[model samples]
Target: MSAPLLEVRDLHKSYQLKGRPALEILHGIDLQLPAGECRPICGRSGAGKSTLLHILGGLENPDRGEILWKGESTRGWDRSRWAIWRRKAVGFVFQSYHLIPELTVEENIRLPAMLAGVPLEESWEDLLDEVGMTLRRDHLPAELSGGEQQRVAVARALVLEPELILADEPTGNLDGASASAVLDLLVKMVRQRQKSLLLVTHDETVAGRVGTPLRIADGRLAGNRS
Candidate 1:
């Protein structure tokens, strides 16, 4: 059988506090994400949801575990190798919109491609339209509403056409209407592009709106709900 798109086995992470023992975050997290699948890790604040997501996305390292990409272990990869993989295969959508204040909306969307040394293809324009931000492409992030900035963020995430998307607290700072709109746009775009999504959210409503819901508490996956 073909391997899963992504998998983790016995994942563990801990943070060292000053003059104290390490505080464990993830306790042997095991997960498998199939190609084109969407999964949500639901947890309260400080429940280790974000840690797991960051580790899975290669932004952080786990103290003990195997992060497998298509059955190949990433344990031996160097920083440059991980960076290359992230650039070519992964995209991230952060809660804060993380747009460069100096860059225009279109510039922010195209930044990834430029960094990856890939050409700005015609699909770039389509992505703007998909996120309903084509008309605002020239505006700075501060000029847009919360929802509009998030729309641009979504466009930025998809601009690279990566196979995997990691979304962290995607709607933590938005109001009800704006949050709903951003979540809807994220799901629709991921589905339409046939990309895999691993979303970390504390809100149960947001979790339910995504695909399968996996609850995490006290550094472990508590349960899975359909």
Candidate 2:
């Protein structure tokens, strides 16, 4: 068996709503993932699935726990450290197509590498071709359909070739057909890239196709082990 690429131990998180007690979201979440493994998480609305994804992606902090990336702890990582880690190791996709409307599809896809101060990858064109958006490369987000935009988002997520992808409801906003297409594209891309995927979604059909199905409730996962 291979070693885990990422691991979380005894993770806990909570939030304080105004005038209310601290509401715990995650309760001692322990997870592990090997290279190229896809882990699908399903939960109802407000089930803390997104919270776990955000924490795993380094976009949010855990109140208490340990996140180990290749056996090294991220306990006290500063913003710079987190930024570097994100640029080099993590890719994130969201329910919303967060493309910059001002940028062309090509530009939007290249933004991560640009921000990371890295030159465009040699595989840049390959990614564009993979997403079947080479013809729309110069079009702005507004010019594309919802599915096209999501295809672009998936391409952008893979542009940096990050080792791990955290997708939170990537198909939520799309219609049935568009969601199916996007979901298929995402799964195909992840498998082709050999990247680890931790997907948070509510759709059973999508979950059934992505990876091993695991349920999340109150921020804890069931039917999932490592």
Candidate 3:
């Protein structure tokens, strides 16, 4: 493939397990995510899937590696630089749906734009329609269901027209039906928007739906290179 939209190299992380030796979380993880590809990086519970996602999203730092976004190295980036990178190039979705309780659907969707100093436009409203949440645009997070909240979250992530989206268990909080719907909507948005997606999930079924799975086992990519 062409130069990846995001490249993770030699990533390593560890945490102190209470009363035990430092527990390693990630071991030399290297993954390349190209533009317009929606791929799942999966592992069982406690397999460091979220860690990898967090590092890739710039929410956390890796101990020993570099992340290249659009061929620019992030290793030397200060917090401010990382923040700017996140606002412009990276979007994130969490399992908890992270919607602001005080904001309406449209307000929540526009949050990223506000952070990036870009005003929301009519096209963003069209994004709400595309995500099947146009009717809930005026509703608050508390007024919406889990699936509805997730839809808004997805729209929020897309508002900045980010090149890459890092979603950590996007469907973990929803039911089977809701999960299916959310996954379908997310995949559609990724394809239609031509944005790359790195989805972190524990469910093989969920992982299978997006793309080929890169399994993480014992803090390493299990049997897969990238």
C-alpha RMSD of each candidate structure in angstroms? 1.1, 1.4, 1.5
The CA-based lDDT of model 1 is what? Answer: 0.90
Compared with the true structure, what per-residue lDDT tens digits does model 1 show for residues 1-226?
8998999999999999999999999888888888899899899999998789889888898999899999999999999999999998998998998999999999999999988888988979999998888888899988999889988889998888899999999999899999999999999999989999999999999988997799888787856634
lDDT of 3 by residue, 1-226 (tens): 3688888888999987789999899989888888888889888899999988888877888889888987888878999998898899878889999999999998999999887788777899888998888887889999988999999999999888989888999999999999999999999988898999999999999999998889999787754434
TM-score of 2: 0.96
Clashing pairs in 2: none
TM-score of 3: 0.95
TM-score of each: 0.97, 0.96, 0.95
Reference-based lDDT, residue 216, model 2: 80
Error of 1 at 117 (Å): 1.1
Question: Of models 1 and 3, which has the larger lDDT?
Answer: 1
What's the lDDT for candidate 2?
Answer: 0.89
- Give me the candidate number with maximum TM-score: 1
> For candidate 2, which ten residues in a row score worst on lDDT?
217-226
